[model samples]
Target: MTRRLLASYLSLVLLALLALELPLGYVYARGELNRFTGAVDRDAVMLAELAEEIIDAHSTDMLPGLAADYAHRSGGRVVIVDRKGAVLADSGASAARGRNLSQEPDIASALRDRSATGTRRDAGTGAEEYYATMPAWSGTSVHGALRLSHPLGPVQRRVHEVWLALAIGGACVLAAAALTALALTRWITRPVHALERAAAQLADGRLAPAPVIDDGPPELRRLAATFTRTATRLHHLLQTQRSFASEASHQLKTPLTALRLRLENFEPYLDPRAHDSLDEAIGEVERLDRMIHGLLALARLENSATTPEPVDLDAVVADRAATWAPFAAEQQVHIAVAGQPAGPAVAVPGAVEQIIDNLLANALRAAPPGTSITLARRRTEHAAELHVIDQGHGMSATERERAFDRFWRAPGTHSDGSGLGLPIVRRLARAGGGDVTLQEAPGGGIDAVVRLQPAAPAEDRFHAGRPRAVARFAAHPARAPRTAGATAGARVPGGSDVRT
Candidate 1:
């Protein structure tokens, strides 16, 4: 940008210089030429007066000496021509005596009793010469003509010197303009660069002691001040929201626990008919407790802001699958793992585990007995994907769209789910620079997918010692071969299966 500005400035300066100096130079050259020619014309007229006296005396003896003296003094050529257009005397060897001068324009004009001045090329030397001619008269009767000739080289040399000076002056002016343009550009761009950096930091959640800029133009300074104010307000608002969520969860959990304990103690003393009602009340309290916990998790995930780091996704999956193995076996369902040797992926410290755990819980709650749930990992050039596939009833398009909304559950599904699981999973995944999505699984159920940033090649080698397991189930007995395929029942809410 600076270079472009400098070039534009120099170009304008050069154009202005050309517009002003070109005409002035032409006028100067013309004036100098006319001044030199006028002086030579006056000298020729005076010499004509002397030549006329000698011609009237009918003697040519003194004419040659006078002409030679004038030529030697003025560094020019002189010639005397008679009225009949024949050369009478010559001052230089180049001007021959008795030569017919009738065809020369200046001499012809002089013979007709008129003075003439002109510039023309010399035939012998091929050099430009200026000529001045006047008639020699004896009482109005023309006797002869006197002519003076001078070379034009000196006049042209003076004009060239003037133009050279103008060119040098123009170059100096353009150089100064370039320097000024560079300084101005730096002054304008410095504050812009500062603002860019400040914006980046603000986007990354660094809001305390907002960026300060006291340099540059007044408009930029005002903009910076406004940005600082906005950041402060945003920080204050976010802190208030987080505090409310944290306080609400803590305050509600205490009372809910006390209520559950009281109901459990009363169960022993109550009659059998009243015991059923008491158990229902206790179950409601437990569901409320789970909802509060989900809210707390959502709030924490939303508040976290940290840079992503490399994590062994395969190890995370294996660990989480192992943790859920006992529950799966109790329900008579098998959990299997299948994937390639995928490298580490970038995610928040523990974000990947939380995501996998939520997906497994959801799948387990939705899967029927004797059906298998598969956890698969796939790697691509730019990202890695983790999928949990279960064989159960899948959702329609509308349900998938609202699946990430807080406290939203599918119609006629289980009431045990707080509906915050998917939302929390989404929040955690996004905070770790990744995303979670739900789609229809092959054959019958839903596929929960999580995409994460791929780690660099250098980071991939750090997880080399970890074991890679494929198509394995933890603590499960081998099943007997079936004579024919058996299909599981359609998924229903609040049935024998757990809620995700």
Candidate 2:
């Protein structure tokens, strides 16, 4: 930006300089040449008067001799013509004396009248010359005319000098302009450089509280102050939101825990028919509990501190698979593992486990019994990939797109789920310098891949270990369902909120 501004400034300056210099130069040259020509003409007239005075006494053979002497002294050619316009004497060539005078109108006119003067060329060489014609009279009677001529070379020399000076001056002006432009560009770019660095630090989330200095131009300083205030406000707002979510989670968990315990105590007293009806109620409560747990997990993941240490992807998948083995076996589902030639790990611990758990749970619930679910880890030059594949019902393109959207359920499916599961998985994976995707599996199931930074020594376990259990179930029958028929308000049980 600074360079462009400077270039525009310099161009305008140069154009102004040229606009003033061109006409001024032309006028100066013209004035000088006119002054020089006037001087030459005056000198020629003075020499003619001197010749007339010197020859007046002798009056017979003296006119021709006087003209020759004038030419030799002035270093200019001289010619004498008779009153009839016939050439009487030439200073350099006496053989052309007494030539026709009618052809030279300027000379004939000068001899016929009193003093008459003009400039013209003789009928010989094309070289330019200045001429002055004067009558040579004896006792006020016109005898002949004297025409003096001189070359115009000196006038040409002065004009050439003027042109050279203007050219040199223009070059100096351009050089000065270039230097000024460079200095101005530096001045403007310095402050912008500082601002750019500050913005980069903010983007990296490493900026803490610091007062910004109001330095640089007025507008620039204002911009810097605005950025500082904006950052501060955003930081405060995020802190407030995190605190609110944590507080809300804590408040909601209390009654949920109490209700779960009461349900457990009531379950034993219920008959078979009541127990069967209560199971559905229990499932709904569990679903609501899972949603709350997901909200809390999302909050925790969002507030997690950055750790640069490399994490083992293979170990994370293997560990999660082992932990979920019993659950998968109860559902009669098989789990397997595969990967790239290079076994590498991602760069986050608990994040990888969370992502794996969400995918595995979704896959197990959707896949048919005895079907195999594959968990594979692979490493390329740039990234590491971990895949969780299951032979379950595959989703359409539209479903795949919104699969990770929070609280968005597929149409016509009755299984209880908190939509926050996939969204949390995706967020955690992305925060760990990785991404997650859902693709078509080999046997018409969903293939969920977790891609991350590939590097470092493979470990049998993650460094940062287990997370706290985030799920709970109802402990009593009446406390379990709380459906519209069961509760006083006729409200459904096991939703986001249970109204009294």
Candidate 3:
């Protein structure tokens, strides 16, 4: 932007210089030529008067001296001729004293009682000369012609110098204008740059990213102030949400746990018929607990600003697949990890695992006995993808579109399911500059895909190949596998493109 602005400014300066200077130089040169010719003509007239007086006296003794003195003062060649064009005295060349100059064009015109003044090329020397011829007349009787010639070399040099000076002046002006334009462009674009940085930080879940830039134009200053205010409000809202989630964690969990434990303690005192009802109640409590956990996780994801870091995609896929393999075997189902190995992907901390865990758990719920669930990792030019493909009857297009809405469950979903899974998955992916989408598998199932922002070829990792991570399944019998990600084609309304 600065370069473009500077170029535009300099271009206008050059055009103005050309428009003004070309005509100015031309007029000055023409005026200088006119003045030179006028001065030469005046000198010619004066010498003609001197020649008239000298010729009228019929004594040519002082004619040569007078012409010589005039020529020495003016740096010109002077000559005196009679009415017949006979050279009476020559100031420059004594050899031309007796020469007849009647045939010369300027001398002929002067002998005819006329004045001639203009430029001509010298026959003897290869140079341009300016000649002024004046006739010597006394009351209608012409005695001779007084002619003066000056070399055009010095005047031409002066004109050339004028042009060179104009060129130098224009260049200096352009340079000054460039410097001024650069400074102005920086001033104009400063707020824009600040806004761009703030937007990036906000996208990364940061609060107020930077201080407002208030030194630009009025419009930009206003925009910066508005943006700062908006960011501040957004930050406050996120902080408030974080506080609520944190407080609700203690308040909501303890009561639900105590209530469930008390309900279970009554199981031993009840009859077998009432025991079934009690079991249902306990199951409801567990489902509520899972829902609360999902809600709190989502709150945390939304409220915290987490920078993306590199994680080995292949290692993550392998570890999670191995962990779920035993669980799939228990249900007489298989977990298959396939597809080409990809480079590391960038995501927020624990985002990949949480997304995969939710998707895999959902896939397991829909998988039939003896069927296989595939975790396929693929790589595009700029991003990696992990597709949790399950062999189940997926939702329709309408349901898929609405799947990303908070707590939006499809028709006929199990009572144990929490609908916040897909929303959490999407937030996690987007935090790392990636996205999630539901695609229909080739075999009538849902291919739940989370696109990954590819990390650098050689990156300093956040948690590269760390085993038994926090989200890893240990003592799995006490905890039911979560359905955090929408494995069965819960998609955003818009379609996606293959970004390379």
Report the number of the highest-TM-score candidate. Answer: 3
lDDT of 2 by residue, 1-500 (tens): 77787888789878987898889888998898677667656765675565455445435356567668877886667777656777656776778776876566667667766554545555576667777777767677766577777666666777788788888888798889888877877666656766777776666655655445555577777777888888777677777877877787778778777776777677889887787567666666666766776676667666555553466565566677887776576667888877654355544545665567667767765767788899877777777888889898878878877887878877776656667767876776677678888898776988887788766664333345543222211111112122222222221111121111
Worst 10 residues of 1 by lDDT: 473-482
What is the alpha-carbon lDDT for the whole of candidate 3? Answer: 0.78
Model 2: residues with Cα > 4 Å off, grouped in runs: 1-207, 210-229, 277-279, 299-327, 339-353, 376-387, 429-437, 449-500
Ranking by TM-score: 3, 1, 2
lDDT of 1 at 318: 80
Cα lDDT computed for each candidate against the true fold: 0.75, 0.66, 0.78
Off by over 4 Å in 1: 1-175, 178-194, 212-215, 274-276, 459-500
Which residue pairs overlap in candidate 1's backbone? none
Worst 10 residues of 3 by lDDT: 491-500
- Could you tell me every candidate's TM-score relative to the true structure? 0.64, 0.56, 0.75
Off by over 4 Å in 3: 1-34, 52-63, 79-90, 96-114, 120-129, 137-144, 151-235, 274-276, 458-464, 467-500
lDDT of 1 by residue, 403-478 (tens): 8887788898744566777887777678767898889988979998889888886876344543333211111111
Give the per-residue Cα lDDT of candidate 1 at 332. Answer: 71
* Highest lDDT model number: 3
lDDT rank order: 3, 1, 2
